[model samples]
Target: MMMNHCGLLTERKEAVPLKSIEVQLEVKDHVATVVSTLNYENKEDKPIEAVFVFPLPGDAAVCHFSAQIGQKHIVAEVKDKQQAKEEYDHALSSGQQAFLLEGSEEISDIFSLKVGSLPPGESASIGLEYVTELAVQADDGLRFCLPAVLNPRYQPQGSESPSVQVTSVPASLVPYSLSFSVQVSSPHAISKVESSCSLEPLQYLNTDQTQATVKLAAGHKFDRDIELLIYYKDAHQPTAVVEAGQASAKPGSLMGDPVVMVSLYPEFPQSVMSSHTSCGEFVFLIDRSGSMGCRMNQKRPQETRISSARDTLLLLLKSLPMGCYFNIYSFGSTFEHIFPKSMEYNEMTMEEALRKVEKMKDDLGGTDILQPLQHIYSQPCIPSHPRQLFVFTDGEVGNTKEVIDLVKKNSGSHRCFSFGIGEGASSALINGIAKEGGGHAQFITGTDRMQPKVMQSLKFALQPSVEDISVSWDLPKGVSATILSPPITTLFQGQRSLIYAQLTGKSSETTEGSVTVKFSFEGHPSKNQLHFSLKPAEDSGLTVHRLAARTVICSLELEWKPNGQQNEEIKKKVVELSVQSGVSSFFTAFIAINKDSPESVQGPLRCRIIPTPLYRAYIDSQVRQCSGKIYCPPSGPLIVL
Candidate 1:
C-alpha cells in the first residue's frame, strides 16, 4: 500500500506517511531551548495540503518557524490571526504555497500547522524553536518532558465551545523515525541525569563539570513521551537570569526592555510547617468518565487507569491529617458521594471510602464535571477548618473556560489542588484552576510516581500559603520596571516562585538593579532580594521577551473573563497585547504564504493523524454500540481529578 498525504495509514495495511523527526534541545540553568525539525513527503498521485496537530508544553514560548523546500528556507512572520488567515486563504485558493502555524484558540498546549499544496512525491521540511522553563521536581530534579501522545479529549454534551478532536493510530502502523538530544549547562555541577527511557551516557563538553550532553539511545522508538530528570549539585540555590531585549524594537516598548527572571525555593519555618497540617476540610473529586477506563501508558497493558486512581485515593485517604473533615465524590454525567457531607477523617470512615474505591469502575457515563463542582460549592463550609479541594482526572473537558471561571469565583472559600492523570491532560484546565483558586497542580503519567506530587500537594494544603506576595524593583533614575505578570499569589513550601519583569528605559552605567519579593509567612514578614549589574546576559535569541509575553498573555487571559458589558473591550485588549508581543495567543496566530506559485489548483485537503509527542495508551478501534459497555485498552491505572 502507498503512503497518504497526512501520515496515518488510511487504507488496509497502508504504509505510514510521516517521514522523520529530529530534535535538539539545550538547557542553560533552568531555561530550555528547543529546535524541532520534521520532514514530510506527499506520495499520493494528486497534490494535497497537509494538516498536522502536535503538542507543546503548556508554558512553552514558541519563537521561530520556517519551511524548507529543497535548498530554499522560508521564515514565517507573526501577524494578527484574522489578517493572517485572510492572506493564507487568498494565497491558497489562488494556488500558492502557504504555511500557517496557529496555537489553538481553545487549548493552549495544542498547535496546528498547515503546509499548503505539495505536488505528488514532493517533500518539505518544517522547523520550529521554542523556549520554556524547566520544572524543578519536589525531589530536587529539573524535569523536562517531550510530549509524544495526544489523547482524544472527551467533551460533555451541549458544551459551548467545539472540542478539539484527535484520531488514534496504532503504534505498529506508525511510519516515522525520531532522534532527540540535549545539551545541558549550569553554574553548579550536575550530579547525574535520569530518565525512564534509555539514553546515551553523559558527554562532558568543558573541562569544568558545568556542561554536558546526552542523547536518545540507538534504535529507540518514538512512542512514549521523552522525559529527562536533571539533578544539580546545588538544587535550591536562588538564581536570576537577565535577558537581553530586541535591538529592532522600540526603546520603550516591552520587547526593548531587558527582562529578568528570578527563581527561588522558599524555606518555611519548621514550627509553622508542623502546625498547618492538622486541620482542614479536604474534598476529593474523581472523574469516572468512560475515558478514565483507559490505561496510563501503552507499554504496560494490565495497569488500568481506574486501578492506579484507586491506589492514589487509598494513599491520600490514609495520609489525611487527623481531625480533618474529608469527603469522596466521583462524577461522570452525574456525581456520586460517599457521604452526604464531609466526614471527619477516621479509621472507620477511611476504610469505608477505601472499600468503595476498590469496587469502583468506570461506571459513570460522561465527563460532566460542572454539576459536581457546583454542588460542592453550594454546600456549607465547615467552621475553623479551611476547605481544600483535590481534583483527579484525565482532563478532557470542552468547557474549560467556564470551569475555570467557576473555580475562580469560589476560590475565596477553598484552595484547589488538581492532578492530571495521563498524557493529553488539558494544561489550560489544570493550570488555570490552580492559578485562579490558590493551589498547586500535579500530573501523573506513565512511569511517573504520583506519590511525590500528591504528597507535596497534601503538604501544601495542610500549611497556610504565603500571603500578600508583592515584588518591588529598585533601578537607576529614569529607568523603570513594568511588571509583565500579575502579582504573586500562592507560595508553597519547597516550590519555586518565579517572577518576570521588563526593565524599561536606561540605567546609569554605574547603577545596579535589584528586586525584592516580600510576603507574610507564618504571620512573620519575609523578603527575598536579588541584585545584578545592568549588563545584558548572553544573547538567547530574545527567548526572555517571548516568555515574558507568554506570561503576560496568560495573566491577562486569566483576568479577562468575557462579560456582557466588557466583551468587545476585553477582546480588543487581548489582540493588542498579542500583536505587540509577537506571540500567538488565543486571539493571534502565525501565518505565511508562498507567492511563487501563481496557477489555480483544485484538490481535496488530506489530513492523516500524526501522533502527539508523549507515550500513550493503545487506541480501541471498535466503537462501542451500547452505553453499558466499557471499552478499555490495556493501560495504567489513570484517574483524573
Candidate 2:
C-alpha cells in the first residue's frame, strides 16, 4: 500500500525555521570553481541523505565531462550493501542512457559516479565535476532539487518519498503550455516571429487579435525574437529589440554567450497565516565586529561595512508599520542591548534605537552570535506575538552546529534572518541559521546595490503571504536525492541554502509538491497554496540550475586575464543568473606582492582584483600613476584579506 503522508507547513508567524547558503567562487586559469558547503546536522536518529540541484545554463555542447563524488562517496545499504555498488557498476557497463534535462534539451554523459559507505553520525560528499566549453557565469546561484526514491525496494528506514518544487521566473513563457495573461505593447502591433524551422509574420494586428500564434515544426527550435514595428509621421528611428536592419529571418544560435541573461527571484508571500496575529516583538542583532571597517567604496564613493549596514537598516526601520514594537541588540565578544525590549512602538524608542546604531563602536572580537540571540529569547518582557531576530555579521563562529541548533530551538516562537556584511562574513552560516529559523538570508558587501536586496527583504516582513511552505519529492524505484539531503525533507526560503542532489537510478515519475499556506492579519485568517506535479522526462524544466552552473564552468575553461575580453564576458554572464549556475565565473579578490620596499609604484597597476565596481576606489587610491610595470610599496601590498 502506498501510504500518502504529508508534513504540514503552516504559515505561523512562529512556525518552522529556514536556513540559507553561502557560495564561494574561485577562478584560476580561466576555470571557475564554485564551492557550496552547507553543514546540516540531522536531529533524527537514523542515517539520511542531503541533495542539492540547480538549473544548467547555456547549450548542452558546452559541458565536456562530469565526475561525481570527489571528496565524499555515497553508498546505499540495500539487502546487500556491496551488491548496490556492483549493480550500479553493471548499469554503467550496460550503456544505459543517462542525461540531465534542461528546458527542452538534454546534457548527456556529464557525470562519473562512485559509491562508499556512510554510517550514522557521519557525513559523505556528493561532488560533481562537469567540464563546460560555453562562456557562462553567475553569482551565488544554482538550481537545487531533492528527489524521492533512492534504491529499489530498499527504502530508507526513516525516509518518506521526497517532493521537490521551485517557482519559475515570471515573464517566462514556455511554448505548448498554458500562456500567462500578457498585455502586448499595442493591440494593433505588428508581430514578427522567427524560429529554427520557419519565420511567420502574423497578419498586421488583425481583427482577431484575441490571441497571437506562432508555429514550429517537430525537432526544430529557434532563438526567437519578438519585436513591434511602429510607424509615425515624423522622422524617428524604428526601435527594434536587436540591431537595426537585422531581420528575424534567421536568428543565429545563442552560443558562446551566457545562458542566464535573465533571472527570476522568488516573491515571498507577506500576509500571516490564519489563526495567528502579528506580535510586535523584534530584535535587531547588529554585528559591529572589527571586520566591518573594511572599505569597499572607491574614489567618488567612500563606504565601509558598518556604513552600508547602517544605511540599509535605517531604510528598513522607516518602512516599519506604525505601533510595531522592536529593539536593537548589538554583539561582539559580549552581547549588549541597544534598547530595552518594549511592546509599544513610539518615536522615543525609534529615535533611541537609531542613535544607538550610529554611536555603536567597532569591537575586534570573535563572533559568538548565539549569546545575543539567547538574550533576546530569554527576555522576560517578551510578548507572545510573532518575534523576529535579524543578525548582521561578517564572520563565522567556531561552533556552527551548536549555534544553529540553539537558534532553531529558541526560534520555536520567532523567525530569524541573517545579513552577511563584508568579505569575512560566512554567507553559508548566516543563510543556514536563517533557514533553520524559518527566515531568509541576504549578503551585502560593498558591491551589491543596497536598495533592491534590502527592499525585497523588507517587503517580506511587511506583508508575509504564506507560512510553513515545505517542499518534498517522490521518485520512482532506484532514484534518490543526489546532491545533498535525503528523500523526505523540509525547505525554508532564508534558512535553507539551495542544493541539488544527483540521481543514479532508472528515471521515472519525479513528483514535487508543497503544503498550502495560511496567513492572519487584521483579525482575519486567509488561506492560499500552490502545487506542481512534474514527471522525470526531457521536457520538464527541472535541471535549469544544473545547466546554468555547467555553462559558467565551461566558460571558465578558456584562458582569460584580468580586464581582457574573456574576463569582461565572464562578468556579463555572472550578472545573468538564469543561464549561469554555481560560482564558476564570480570574480575573486586577491593580493599581490613581490620584492617589497619598492621606492614608488608605477604604471597602470594591472593586478587581479575583486569583481565589484566599488573596489576600484581603493585600487586607485593606493596605486600611484605610472607606465609599464609597476611596483607595490613595502607596507602597501595588494591584499584582499
Candidate 3:
C-alpha cells in the first residue's frame, strides 16, 4: 500500500476531471422548479466517460433532460427503463457519445448521470430539471435543500440485490464547482430568507415584497447540502391555485386536465399544545456502524459522527420529562439496550445513559438497523403513556423499503421521529420511516445546529394527535374532481398538508370551487374551508401535471403487498403513469440523443467517478497507520450513579 507524507497508508483514489455546475431554482408559491447544468470537459487526450452520482429530494418530479455537444443541442425523452438502457448501451458500443440520466429504484434520493464518449478537450453541457414541494420546516419556514453530499451508502450482507452503487471521494477532491441562485415568488409578502451557507442579500424586485431573488455568496464551496429557508409574513394561511392544462394535448388526460393545488396549514388546537411535563415513553435508537465513525462535517474532522450523535443524545436525555420512561439502544450488526425495559427518566438513569453514550464508538460492524428496530417494535407498549421512537442514523441502510415497511406495520404502537446525522443522510429512509410511522423527520447536516430540530420533534411527539382526517371538495354543477394524492393518514401541529385535484367536466364562468378539510381534535370535529374562483391561473405550465403524476405513481408504488399479483399490478401502474406523464419513475428513464457521426473523432476512453464528501473511517484508518499499529483510546466503564 502507498503511504503519504503523514506516514499513513492512503485510501484508494479515483480521478474525476470535471469543471463547474450552475443551479437555478424558481419557486412559485410553494413548489420549487430546479434546473442544474453541468459543464464537463475532458482535459485528457482521450475520449472519456464520466459518471456523476448526485442527490435530489426524495419527492422531486424530474421532467426534463438535455445536452449540448459541440454546438449541437439535443433534448432527451422519457422511455421504458429497459429500452432506454438498451439504447444507451448500443450507442456506447457503436463508438458514439451518449448521455443517460436515471434515478435509483432502491433509493429515490440518489441519481446517476452517465455521459459517455466525450472527445478529447471537448466539453459537453448537460442540464436537468425537477420540481418538488418545499417542506415547511419546524420553524415555520419553507425549506429547500440542494444536496451536495453523495456519501457512500452501507449495503448490508445477505440483503436484496443492489441497484445503484455510490462511490465517494473527499469533499476537497470533488472536482466540480457549484454556483446557485433562486427566484422566489408568492402571494404572501416575503419576510426573510436564510441559509447555512453564506448568501448574497435578498434582492426584492417589487415594492410589495411579493417577489425576490437570492444567491449563494461567491467563494462558497460545494462541501455540503445547500439549504435555503424562506419565511413569508403569513406562512400558515391557506391558498388555492388552479393551473391550465397543456393546450396541445387531448382533453380529459392528466396533461389536459385542469389541476388545482390546495395548501392547508391549520394550527393545532390550544388543548393539544404540549410542554416538557407531558409524559411519554421515549426510545432512542442510535446507529454506531463503521460509517458512523466518519466525521459529521468534512471540514471539521474532530467533530465525528459518533461524537455529534452523543452530544445530541445527551441534550435529548436531559430534556426528557421527569416522569417519562426512557431507554437507549445502539445498533450496527446487532443491537443492545440500555435496560431490559424502558426505565424511568430519573437523574440516575439519565447519567448512566449519558456515560454510555460518551463511551459509544463506531466499533459495531456494518449497519443493520432492522435488527434493532424489529426488537423495539416487538416489545409491549407501556400503559397510559404514548410511545415516541427517536432514531438517529447516518442513513446508510440499503434495505430502505424493508425498514420503512417494518415501521408502517408497527406504526400503531408508536410514532417515530427520525434524524439524518450527516450531509449524506438518505432522505428516502429518514422521511419514509417518519411518514409511515406518522411522525416527522429532521436532517442535521454540515454545520447545522441539532438542538432546535430534535427538541421540535420532541415537542410534537409529546403533543396530542388529531384523528379522522378527511377532505371534501365542492365543484361546479357539471364539474367533478378526482384526488391525485393519497389519503391523509396523520396530522401534526405546524405541518403543512397539500392536496392536488384534477377537475373533470366544465364549469360556468361565475362558478366557484371550495374544499374543506375536516378532522377531529380533542373531543369535537373541526373543519377548514377555502373558497376560490374556478378561473384558471394563466401560463402555470406543466408543473401541476408532473406533480400530480408523481403523486399517483408514488402512491401506487408504495402499495406493495405479499401477493405476486398485487406487486405486478403496482409495477404496471407505475410504468403506465411514468410513460403517460413523460416523467422519470422507478420503471422509466430519460435518455438523450447520441450516435456516431461522419465527423466523429474516436480515441482511447477514460472513466471518472465524481467524488462526494469524504468519509471519516477512511481518514481514521489513515491516522492509525502512524506506526502500523491500531491506535486504541482509553475510556472508563459507564456507571449509573
Best by TM-score: 1
lDDT of each: 0.73, 0.35, 0.75
**TM accuracy, model 1:** 0.91
For residue 289, model 3's alpha carbon misses the true position, in angstroms, by 1.5
Give model 1 RMSD, 1 decimal. 4.6
The model with the greatest lDDT is 3
lDDT of 2 by residue, 335-438 (tens): 78765555466777777777767776555343456677777878764544466677777543434444566776765676777776643244335655765676
Weakest lDDT window of 10 consecutive positions for candidate 1: 632-641
Every model's TM-score: 0.91, 0.41, 0.89
* CA lDDT, candidate 2, residue 216: 25
Candidate 2 wrong stretches, greater than 4 Å = 1-279, 297-301, 464-641
Over 503-616, each residue of candidate 1 has an lDDT whose tens digit, in order, gives 877745656878888888868788778787767777566777888888987766666665556756666777776777667677777776666543555675554444323334
For candidate 1, what is the lDDT? 0.73
Model 2's TM-score against the true structure = 0.41
Pairs that collide, model 3: none
lDDT of 3 by residue, 1-641 (tens): 12222211113432344567788999987899999888877776677777756677888899999998776888998887889899988887777888888877777776778888887777888888999998777777788888765545556666663523333334455456777899999999999999878999999999999999999999775455677889998888888888888787679987788888888877765654533248889999998877776666646767777788887788889898898999999987778888999999898988888888889988776678989998998888888888899999988766787788899888887899998887667788989899889889988764465778878888788776677888998887889889998888777766788899998899565579899989887656787889987888876888878998898887776776545568877878788778778778887898986553445547556665444434332422421211111110000000000
